[model samples]
Target: MKNRLLRFYLYFILYLSPALAFAQADVPAGARAAALGNASVTLPDLWSLHNNVAGIANLQQAHFGAYVENRFSMRELTTVALLAAIPTAKYGSYGLSFSRFGDELYSQQHAGLGVAHKLGQFSLGAKLDIWQIAAEGYGSQKAMALSVGGQAEIIPDLYFGAYAYNLNQAKLAAFEDERLPTIMKAGLSYRPYHKLLLVAETEKNIDYNATFKAGIEYQLLQNKFILRTGFQSLTNRATFGAGFIARHLLVDYAFGSTTLLGTSHHLSVSYLFSRRQAS
Candidate 1:
């Protein structure tokens, strides 16, 4: 029976998967970031609420965004996220983010509130995150994590960024030292021309091998249309994406492929409440 098979699959994952290796569980969101192979620490966008919190400081207008990603064409591996950013006159930017991964059989959810302050060419940010894990048969576990990030424009057209996720090493369970993934990332972004941008970054998780990523983006039609491509060393995945930007609304889509995981698709949409003019 289909229902019988589904139940068996759930039991297999819940009991056997963790023992093999506990997942990092820090799912990345946003088609733009995915299109760029996740080399996004320095890129500034609405979804920066999930990438580098400090990157939101670059926004001058209020923004709201929604994102969805389907990995390996599996509904159970899909991720959905909602994000918002509000910029102030004297203060910096405030951000809120919510994301969920997996289906009812198993899932992880995150809710976070963050603020980023821009100080001249440098910006700093911190977020308080509540993480929860739930399973169909088992109950749920919740913990708090702290994330911090900073971005700096080193020179004209060059920028640097770094972020620390789950710096406090929040615990998931007392047995087997089960805990949330703690990750650190640092990267650089360079723009030689207004139309072309390049990014490279390295990420390290205490429990896994370091991952290196790089991406290239080009804009056409005066930034109304954009094209992007990227590669990740961790999974040997190649990603391609494109974006269409109107006056207030932006839409982006990404496609990625790997020999092991088949393929993945990501799509995101965002709206800017108002455009900020130069003072």
Candidate 2:
């Protein structure tokens, strides 16, 4: 009977859900970004590969991370991702990331290879992504998506970023006819002092209205601990998150509230293979 119900649910989404919307790619993977209301498009973290592929091109060290988010207490809707980024001496930085959503009954996944190069104060990056959708007894579909992004420092402590996803308007589902949503994003990050950072972003998806977001991060305890908070206009959600960075380890958690979807919790852990030196 459980299998029967699961099959029925799959059929329902296969036919009806596309009319609603689809963005397995938009699920937030970085907990710090979630805490900041999915405003990480311009943040300087390797995990930003999930939000904006170019955001991590400037990272100086090799980093690996894993994270998960549970939405409204539904395990099937939970999102999980693993990411890694390495900086090469001459070729710029390279990143590999994979993200999955849903359960055995239905699922979506993305595997991507990304590269970024820094030219003076400006950084340019691009990601090539393979997207897949699968459902039990219904087979699967695969397609490729492309994204390009760039970021630059307007001054010593202020930065701007922009990226576009699904430039080809890729389609998903082997049997069903559906197209991946193309999205565009732009944002800014400002540092008023050594320990405080502020961010604002705007994102537009082809199928929906534009979203506006803002976030702030503050470093404490000599950069050992961090506090973060942010807000989003799309869902009227507010988020808060905190982080603990000790030597080579990183731990992060985020919580956000919304009206219809209730609340979401995100957690992530990362390690820096070559920890940054103290300033």
Candidate 3:
């Protein structure tokens, strides 16, 4: 059974390798960068739903967030996420989160459920994913995937993390014969002061493209307000953006401009609920 599962995974990877290559051919240029740049790093509140999953595991309280973005004035994207962390009697700490991503035009939906367990200085996490794509006049397909991640404390105030997404190599549909892209990401975060943090991440896809992102955050008004800024690079395009946080609410906005796409804008908002012990 294990060998059979392994063979299936290998075949899935082989089949999806070309899809990533095809996706790289057109090079959307600044689509992802414009939307995700300069967002939060740790519990970034609003953009965390799409930026990184490990960030959600660091939350001290239960949190829920919803966001919407307009892409190039052509499509609308929306997301909702819920996250919680609770102390356990023998397991140290446990974290859970669920997120959904959807677009209007093509009716693409991506949903994920994640769990993490903290052990001393190390943390492990895994995610189950469901993806679907459908259109008004076309057939719709769905797939199942998995993602695994880990985070470790490298120093007193610094941490490192790595994650592999879409590890299952699941097919989008039985008839479509296309596979979802697989991606790997690694990042580091540091806190220089009590209320300031710096983060950087590098990601690579099977499609042969690499991305580098960096951001910083500062707290103000006794932790009631926060400000953030960052930059990222994809191919030859550059993106920058900022965010604001007030108490349990957060708002983020980013802009990307390239010789190809001209200029694009993205905005997201989220709210964190009060901390509660898990039942």
Best by TM-score: 1
lDDT for 259 in candidate 3 is 66
Which residue pairs collide in model 3, if any?
A: none
TM values, all candidates: 0.93, 0.91, 0.72
Query: 1-279 in candidate 3: lDDT tens per residue?
Result: 995675455435533465522232111111222433432223322223334444445555555444444433433233344444443444433444444433332345555666666667776666676766554445677777787777778889888877776787777655555676777778887889989877778877776678787766677777655555566677444465666667777666666556664555655555666665665
Query: What is the TM-score ranking, best to worst?
Result: 1, 2, 3
Q: Between candidates 1 and 2, name the one with more favorable TM-score.
A: 1
lDDT of each: 0.87, 0.84, 0.55
Worst 10 residues of 3 by lDDT: 24-33
- Pairs with steric clashes in candidate 2: none
Model 3 has an lDDT value of 0.55
CA-RMSD of model 2: 3.0
Worst 10 residues of 2 by lDDT: 19-28
Candidate 1 local lDDT, residue 93: 93
- lDDT winner among the candidates? 1
Could you tally the backbone clashes for each prediction? 0, 0, 0
